[model samples]
Target: MEIMQSLTDGIMLGGIYGVISIGLSLVFGVLGVVNFAQAQFLMLGMYVSWTLWKLLGIDPILGIPLTGAVVFIIGYLIEKTLIQRILKAPPVAQIFLTVGLMIFLENAVLLIYGSSFQSVVVSYQSLGFHIGSLFISAPYLMAFTAAVIVCAGLWIFLSRSWFGKAIRATSQDSDAAVLCGINVKQVYALAFSIGVALTAIGGAVILPYMTVSPSVGGQFSILMFTVVVLGGLGNVAGALVGGLVVGIIQSLSTMVFPVQLQNLILFIVFIGILAFKPEGLLKEK
Candidate 1:
């Protein structure tokens, strides 16, 4: 029963984890850039949601669209102005640029929002339901539901929409996409925008269960990378699977390991995966 309970909690947490990591995967897929600053965009989304809740009395979950929109615009602009320039640069240059962006974003938020931690107070924050002996948390359920909806919407948009096809084509081969009459530059900007927006929505949904601080993105940076790498860096569907696996490992480990050692366990798994299956668990042949 206890193990079952942990599995349920892990699934819920994993859904949200998938949502957060998808953006990083998308950016790398389409742009071929390892965006070290992607998690900072998650932090930015949290701040946007927090601002809306503090000033307008909007619940963070309810403000997901607004959070996504705000971050989407910011992402679009950043990609156009900065990332576009480095699209064809050497890998080291791209890495340094993104790392610098990460530092700038973190310090910028610290300057603007200060060092205080913030969180939302929603009606269902502490509510939960029980199915026999397994209990489900309200915030976790809501966040997981939202994550599912977002993932489904993204899949439809990617597989059905014309622009989505263009994005996929660009990812497969940007030069070929251009020869096929697709505007590769526009696709890059839009893909980056959509990627970060999805992550921002993830941040919004989890506000009920998480506190926001300037350094919060740092907490999830390594975790996000592990999820994406575990699933395959550019594989979107793999990210969801990886998230579930990681979430389950995290939850079950807590039963036998100390809280401080939970991440240590995850790190071990991450290292093992990298050493044995660098192509990721879901890599295609």
Candidate 2:
């Protein structure tokens, strides 16, 4: 039963990681850009949730829409004002732009929030339910559920909606999509916006499990990037799978390896995957 509880906890954590990484995959898929600044977006979402819950007394769940709306608009504006102009330039431009964005957002956030760590002081977090004699934190369960809904919504948007299809078409071949009267630039902007919004949602949902700090976004960025690559760049399903696999590895490592070395286990697996199947388990169309 102790073992069972640990396994359950591992799976729950992995679900959150997988959900968080999907946005990274989506942005890479459509924009052909490695958005190093994704961490800042995650931070923004978390900060908003912290603000709402810790400051305004709103629940974190209720803050989702507020965070999402803010990040979505910021994403759209960022792309329109800066990213769109460099779409046709070399890929290096995207990298540089993203790096610049990383510095800007980080510094801006520090100036706004300062270095003080923030957390939502909720008493319910300590409360947990036992399944088969294993304790499960309420926050992990909540995070898992929220992550699923958000990812499912993204999948539906990509598979069912016309604009989603347009994004897909553009991802496959932007020139061909253009011939079909799809506005490639518009699709890119919207896709970036949606992708950033995903990270925001993740931040808001997982705040209960994590403390808010400027540097935390950088940590999320690395984890999400690993998930994106393992899942395959541009492959949403692959990212999901990759996220779960990473979560499992991380969870298991706590038992088998030293606490400090747990992160290394994930790196070993990720490198193995990259070497064995660079395209990922599920290749996007």
State the TM-score for model 2: 0.95
TM-score of each: 0.98, 0.95
Off by over 4 Å in 1: none
* C-alpha lDDT score of every prediction, in listed order: 0.92, 0.84
Predicted model with the maximum lDDT: 1
Per residue, candidate 2 scores C-alpha lDDT tens digits across 1-285 of 655665787788778888777888888889888888987899989998898886688777667888898899999999999888887789888889999998898888899999898888666677788765778788888888888888888889899999999999998999999999999989999999998988888899889878988878877776787788888899988888888877877777777788788667767776777889877777665
Clashes found in each candidate (C-alpha, N, C closer than 3 A): 0, 1
Model 1 quality (TM-score): 0.98
Q: After superposition, how far is residue 235 of candidate 2 from its true place, in Å?
A: 0.5
Error of 1 at 96 (Å): 0.7
Native-structure RMSD, model 2: 1.5
Residue-wise C-alpha lDDT for candidate 1, range 1-285, written one tens digit per residue:
999999998999899999999999999999999999989989999999999999999988889889999999999999999999999999999999999999999999999999999998989999999999899899999999999999999999999999999999999989999999999999999999999998889889888899999999988888888999999998989988999888899999999999799789888988998999999999833
